[model samples]
Target chain A: MSNAGLDSAYDVAAVRQDFPILDKPLPGGMPLVYLDNGATVQKPRSVIEKLVECYENYNANVHRGIHSLGDQVTTELEAAREKVRALLGADEVEEILFTSGTTMSINLVANAWGRKFLRAGDELLLNEMEHHANLVPWQQIAHERGAKLRFIPLTADGRLDLTALDDVLTDRTKLVAVTAMSNVLGTINPIGEIAARAHARGALVLVDAAQSVPHGLVNVNDPRVDFFAFSGHKVYGPTGIGVLYGRRKILEAMDPFLCGGNMIRRVRKESSDFAELPSKFEAGTIPIAQAIGLGAAIDYVQGLGFEAIAAHEHQLTARAFDQLQQIPGLQIVGPGLAHRGSIVSFTVEGVHPHDMAELLDRKGVAVRAGHHCTMPLHEWLGVTATTRASFALYNTHAEIDALCEAIQYARQVFRRK
Target chain B: MSDDLYDDYILDHYESPYHRGHLEQPTIAHEDDNPLCGDRVHLELLVDEHDRIKEAWFDGHGCAISQASASILMKDIEGKTLDELRDFQAKQMLDLLKVRLTAARQKCGLLSFKVLKTMVYTLDERKGAMSPTQGGRG
Candidate 1:
């Protein structure tokens, strides 16, 4: 594929056109000013049409069917896996396992690897800012395996207290699970540094890239990274399909997570053997069309290049900070713009997040409001909830202005008597 | 998508709620939250010898709709019999707000109703009258 972004100037209008939903007028006639990218991004036309194409043609079960359509579907399926493997810079396609989403991917490791290795006193290092997807699975597995959960304290600014890494990364720490970017705080963590520290203590690192992978470049082959997980929907791909890249040696040694028809290598009435690296985990007829759509999404993101995506998103984040902070009572949470991604979570002095979100929605700007699945982080921030306006490559500076305007409107409505 | 969602009437109740503080020596009380958005409601009622509401007060933090719902609920429940309070429905609360709400926002509008329902139900159970206390939820 050609370097589409490298060869030309980054055009927001062109990027917006690629995603049909971005320009569409809402039912009330206002233009859609979608800033909920941190939750699930708007899909480009290519990914949408690719899903339609996959369903229209070669609509058959993969791997088992001897018919022509079956072979075609199987080829497309494996090709999609290969695309994901390459996207993550893994050593082989076999190392990439397609699950339902990042939640399922993390659960697989927690069950397959965690259940096998965790002893009663063994510790799992996590942080307060982690999304529920990263925090919950480890909590479940730790509870089941009689393991202890240790949190890496956050600095008052909401960034992880890396200075205290030595305090938590002890020999008993079996796994260090963390999000590459704070979904609530927008803090970009130093994953490579964290991994190095954890590895020194013989603990494996699992990167929850659900928020990070979609906005920037990520290579699972980073030697310090033992496993990486992300959802396709968050990256402008179809929902119900996600990726889990595990170290080859680690995956080969662990027992399978799910058991069923397509995941077996051979079966006897009394005994059965499991399939290979990916098939061992993919039990039923997988999300065939969604996986292919995810491939298209990878191609779409690759064509845009992460450098352009990051630069554009940083501009949006900066605009939001400059304008949002200027709002009399608004306090932006998480780290400052220099240390974050495109996400900006904040709370107005007088308005609640739910009210803020509703008022913003009235202006056709869709932002998420709540604890954002990080109750601990919200508690640490000493607020019940915060309004988040997360950006993507297709977002414009005008959208940031609209967000600020909506906040002003909300403030006026909630101003003291 | 209309600013009318939080218009003058709703904002009026939100800014200067009629019963926005705690009540002392309340006969019935309950506290609950909308886990979906962390919106909470604490409703307290002081009842007379004949099971009629003498006073109603509320304490909580949340969106305008929920807070306003409680503020108005305090007005509607005063001097109301426990039976009448039990008969109060989620739709009535929305109707009182004078605003259109989607299903999700309806939860915010009904948060006070939820706390009030629980408080009344617990009272009914104590009185051996557990016949589905509150009307249909929003």
Candidate 2:
């Protein structure tokens, strides 16, 4: 799967056929050029069929029922867990716990682990480029425990100034939470290196893989990541289902965040015992159909192969960078294509992001605009908001060209004023 | 190139906003920010003894629709009484902008008017002024 042949073998047209939404037209009968993959990706037909199959056939609650449909659903749910484990290259299926989404996963760690372990004067190291999902949870824990929140500043080119890592990670540092890929700047952080540095100082690392896991390879057993989390919707899977992969020992030691029915082992008159490993974290009846759909998504992505997906997205991003750079007043916010993921966020001088996004929408180019849930990062960059066009495997070079033309048209519309 | 959303007047006020500055020793002042998009608006109104708004100013950064609508609102509010400002509805701002916005963009276009309405309501609440009918304009 990691071979060079897979990279050259990518056929985007064939890939686009699997996603039915690619053929849909906009309100004005223009072909839709969806470039908002960072927010969420359109699901493939295989994934959609899997969801229908789950509901149309074996629609039952898992883990407790002894009936035939329940047994089948429980088996499917566990199989989905195994698929997620294999996706993260984890050793055991028990390490993967399904939550609602990435936000829930991070909050599980922050409350279950941080509230129990972190004390006053402790340091929680995070980067400035993190989405509010990653930043706010840590901020809450730090505030609750009287711990100090430290940041790894971004460089002039929108990269983590890792030169300050040594100063940031101290013996008092309890955890280091960072995004594997920035949602706004598109800069892919060196998670392994950051994890290694944090581990050397006896600090645990949590990688927010909501952006990277969908686009490239993410191995939970990489020795640097003690915990990892991602959303199903971001990875071309169904929404309302996400994964939190934690090392077994750490999960065994931490307290449960949500206490309810499915997560409890036994209940006494005044006391109760919690379930084991992953079940201890999964409180309610899980998102059964969504998890199965996520399994189908993982199968689709693995079938296409990570190497091919990365190569295809790299080509699209490179071409977009080249063409978008030619537009006057269009300043790209992140690093060059070499260090970025499939996202390209930029600002057009004298044009507001909302205006550009609206104009681009009229031309059937779907993009994202605003702070992108990274207000601190935008403030650090001295911009209120930026218009971002993020790519996926189903995207084509022609779509990139269309995006460039739409941007030029938006500039013309603004200049007319 | 005239889309229904961004007309010449909206772009003009966006490029050159009127009364976009701070007011000294204002009678009523408040600021609010849209954290989702980072659009902020700080408004100040100078009220005379007759309860007329002698001057109105706003300072913030946002999209063209917001800035332009704020500029239009600045011109509309000058020399009006506090009651008149309170009776100003969000629909009036939308009509003035002359654009049909999506549900999301509608928030951006009406943000300034909402901020001003909040400021006036706060003033009424503080001074025990304005009956329910006058202060209840949305």
Best by DockQ: 2
Model 1 has an lDDT value of 0.88
Q: What's the true lDDT of residue A197 in model 1? A: 90
Give the Å error, residue A37, model 2: 0.3
Candidate 1 stretches greater than 4 Å from native: A1-8, B1-3, B129-138
Looking at candidate 2, what TM-score does chain B attain? 0.86
Per-residue C-alpha lDDT of model 1 across residues A1-417, encoded as one tens digit per residue: 122333223777777889887777999899888999999999999999998998898889989999999999889989999999888899888889999999999999999999888999999999999988888988999999899999999998889999998898899999999999999999999898999899889999999999999887588756459999999999989999999999888998889888998889999999899998788889988899999999999999989898888887887788788988878878999888888999999988878998888888888989999999999888889999999999987888878888888888888878732
Please write out the lDDT profile of model 2 over residues A95-147, one tens digit for every residue. 99999999999999999999999999999999889999999999999999999
Give candidate 1's root-mean-square deviation (CA, Å): 4.1
Taken over the whole model, the C-alpha lDDT of each candidate is 0.88, 0.89
Supply candidate 2's per-residue lDDT for A86. Answer: 90
The per-model DockQ list reads 0.72, 0.74
Q: Pick the candidate with the highest TM-score.
A: 1
Q: Which portions of model 2 miss their true places by more than 4 Å?
A: A1-8, B1-3, B23-25, B122-138
